[model samples]
Target: MTHAFYVYASYGFAALVTIVVTVWTWADGRARRRELAALEAAGIRRRSARPKDSLGDGE
Candidate 1:
């Protein structure tokens, strides 16, 4: 009822998954920041466009 191979396999799989996730997260964060900076430099704010008030009563 021993499980030496199972323990080793589980550890190896965990390590592989951790490495992949870390690399993917780092790349995505860097790319996102770079894109935001470029947009700001071009005077383009994506979230600044909001709708105006709709109570048409002649202000």
Candidate 2:
């Protein structure tokens, strides 16, 4: 019964990390999609990193 503090803290920390990663991934995907859409609308027709090019080319 005396370990309730640790248990509560662990649960709180787990929730915080979960919330953080969820938000981070969501924001990242949304931003990338928006940028891609804008680029398409602007007629770039290509991502900064072309699929044909290797990752070493640059992001």
Candidate 3:
């Protein structure tokens, strides 16, 4: 019912959102890395990972 209560509640909600997003991003990155590793193990590679000379761009 007071201004201070509203402010504190808003700040708490923002903090909670920030922490959730941070954890979600971290977990997604780990999952993507694992997927990339699996793909590499299956003989798939990112084009950028190839040697520049192998691209045959007349280096």
- The residue-by-residue lDDT of candidate 3 on 1-59, one tens digit each, is 99999999999999999999999999999999999999999999998899867988764
Can you give the lDDT of residue 37 in candidate 3? 98
After superposition, the stretches of candidate 1 with alpha carbons farther than 4 Å from their true spots are: 46-59
lDDT of 1: 0.85
RMSD after CA superposition, every candidate: 5.3, 5.5, 2.1
What are the clashing pairs of model 1? none
Please provide, for model 1 over 1-59, each residue's C-alpha lDDT reduced to its tens digit, 9 standing for 90 to 100.
45988999999999999999999999999999999999889988764453466335464
lDDT ranking of the models:
3, 2, 1
Instruction: TM-score for candidate 1, please give it.
Output: 0.67
Which of the predicted structures, 2 or 3, would earn the higher lDDT when compared with the native? 3
Q: How does model 3 fare in lDDT?
A: 0.96
Best by lDDT: 3
Q: lDDT of candidate 2 vs native? A: 0.87
Number of the candidate with higher TM-score, 1 or 3:
3
Best by TM-score: 3
Cα TM-score per model = 0.67, 0.69, 0.88
